[model samples]
Target: MELTYKNSKTIDSEQLKNLYNDVGWTAYTKDIELLQQALLQSLEVVSAWDDHNLVGLIRIVGDGLTIIYIQDILVLNEYQNKGIASQLIQDVMSRYESVRQKVLLTEEAPDVRHFYEKQGFQSCDKGDLVSFAKLN
Candidate 1:
């Protein structure tokens, strides 16, 4: 497969929905309009495509100067383990290489932690930092 990546903020709702669904992020797929708007509003986005098929994506939100938070990174289950997620992250990190703080919140799964760790991320405890979130 000739995979290509694009740093774009625009994605059709249908395509975005399909990609989110394919990755089992049904919570996102359930609201295509909201998802589309979220994609449009993100500070940066990197998407992977196989021809016309949307296969993976990552989104970031922040002030673009002080802190950059990686909001989401996902690849189709079939596309996982092929380094697509890593490449998307690499692209983001490269673009924000000068940013002071980079952050992401993810489930505390071993494989997930390992993946981020491999990409130079450290757990909050390991770094002597604390993270908190409030969801309404």
Candidate 2:
């Protein structure tokens, strides 16, 4: 199967939500509103496609110049081990490498780490970070 990756304005929210769920990632539960905002926020985002199907996605949320946080590296289960996700990351990293190349938070998968390591990301135990959550 041929793999294609690209930066897109297309936001197939339902397809993404289903892909996320199939990959055992947390369910966003058809949150089209959030996906709409996310699609708007994604800077230099990359997606993997097999024909008309969206098999994978990687979102970069940050200033175009610096501090790109790589999140939501989702690939459909059937498409795993095909190196599509790696290509997606490479697509994002190539442009940002010259500016700022620090991936703050990753989903922490060994297979994923192996891919990143191949791309030159060393394991770091302690580093700068932050988080906050609010519920009503």
Candidate 3:
């Protein structure tokens, strides 16, 4: 399979839908049309395509060259544990090498946390920036 990675500058609406859903984030469904606007300038959307399909993806949202927040790391179930996530994250890291801080948040799952650690990320005091939605 041919592996490919591209940034937000190259992504259109259709590709966004495919890659976002490929990572198990159905919540993005309602936001499909808004993704483009939400991801305005300075965001780098990283995606890995296996020839004919989008298998993995991650988005580095940040103010170019300073600090970056890595988000939406999704690897299709069929492609999980096969190093596609690793490569996708690595590629994103490289693309934002100019940034002094790179961050991401995931529900406190052991396996999920371990995956991030494998990429050299350390757990730290996140401070007062986290909030959750209240389902009515």
Candidate 4:
């Protein structure tokens, strides 16, 4: 299968919702309107498409200058384990290569850590940094 990537923020909400659902991120898929608004306001977005299908996406938020937070990076289950996630991340890192800080909050999993580490991300613990978050 051929995969195409785009750096765009014009994705349809329904398509975004479906992809989120496919990955079991029910938290976002449950509120399509909120999801759409969040996507609309993101500083940048990189998405992967399998022809007409939206297969994966990575969203960023924050000013382009100082710090950029990787809000979400998801690939449909069937589309995982390919180089899609890596490519998507490379695109973002390339765009923000000069930014001082690039951050992401994700579940603590060995595979997850390995994946990000492969992309040149150092965990907070390893880097002697601390991260805190508040979810409401």
Candidate 5:
């Protein structure tokens, strides 16, 4: 597959819905308008496309100078294991290389941990740091 990557906040709504739905991220797909606005407000958004198909995406948010939060990273199920997600992450990282803190919070799963660890993220406790969240 010839994959093309784009760093743009503008994305077709249908493509965004399809991609989020493909990955079963119902929280995003259930409210496409909110998702789109979130992307517009993000510090950066990197998307992977296979021709007309949106296969992967990585969205980041926060002040670009001191800290950046990795808000989302996803690849279609069929497209996983092919490095698309990694490329998306790399695109964001490279763009914000000077940002002092890069942070992300994801579900606690073995594969998830391994993937982020491989990409140079240490678990919060590893650095004697703790994270808190308030999700409704």
Candidate 6:
């Protein structure tokens, strides 16, 4: 299937819900309005689409000049491992290449580490750095 990528913040509620639910991110799907609002306020959102279907997305937030955080990067389960995630990451990296710091906090899994490392991200433990977050 042919895929297209674009820098867009608009997403259909049903499409957003379905994509997040397919990836088991039920918290986001539980409140579509909040999720949509978050997307609207993000610094940038690069999305992948197959025709009208939302297949993957990478959302960024932060001061675009100094730092950028990868707030969310997800691909539909059926769309995983076809280079969609990699491409999404690459797209964001290219867009923020001049930024001094790029960061993301994800579940610590061997596969997850490997994926980000493959994209040139070093683990916090590997460097003189640490990160903390407060989640509800």
In model 1, the Cα lDDT at residue 126 comes to: 83
Question: What lDDT, from 0 to 1, does candidate 5 have?
Answer: 0.91
What tens-digit string does per-residue lDDT give for candidate 5 at 1-136?
8999998898999999988898888889888999999999998898999988989999989999999999999999999999998888877788889988999999999999999999989999687888988998
**TM-score for candidate 4, residues paired by index:** 0.96
Candidate 6: Cα lDDT at 75: 98
Superior by lDDT: candidate 1 or candidate 2: 1
Taking all chains together, the TM-score of candidate 5 against the true structure is: 0.96
Best by lDDT: 6
lDDT of each: 0.90, 0.73, 0.73, 0.93, 0.91, 0.94
For model 3, residues 61-134, the per-residue Cα lDDT tens digits are 77867788875788777878989889988887776777788877777888987888899887664455544545
Ranking by lDDT: 6, 4, 5, 1, 2, 3
Most TM-score-accurate candidate: 6
lDDT of 2 at 113: 71
User: What C-alpha lDDT, on a 0 to 100 scale, does residue 104 get in candidate 5?
Assistant: 97
Q: Residue 29 lDDT in model 6?
A: 84
Error of 6 at 50 (Å): 0.8
TM-scores for the candidates? 0.95, 0.80, 0.77, 0.96, 0.96, 0.97
Worst 10 residues of 4 by lDDT: 29-38
- Candidate 6: RMSD to truth: 0.7
- Across 18-91, the per-residue lDDT of candidate 6 in tens digits comes to 99999899999889999999999999999999999999999999999999999999999999999999999998
Better-scoring candidate (lDDT), 3 or 5? 5
| lDDT of predicted model 4 | 0.93
Give the residue spans of candidate 6 off by over 4 A: none
After best superposition, candidate 1 residue 117: deviation in angstroms? 0.2
Ranking, TM-score, top scorer first: 6, 4, 5, 1, 2, 3
Per-residue lDDT of 59-124 in model 4, one digit per residue for the tens?
999998999999999999998998899999999999999999999999999999999999999999
The model with the greater TM-score, 3 or 5, is: 5
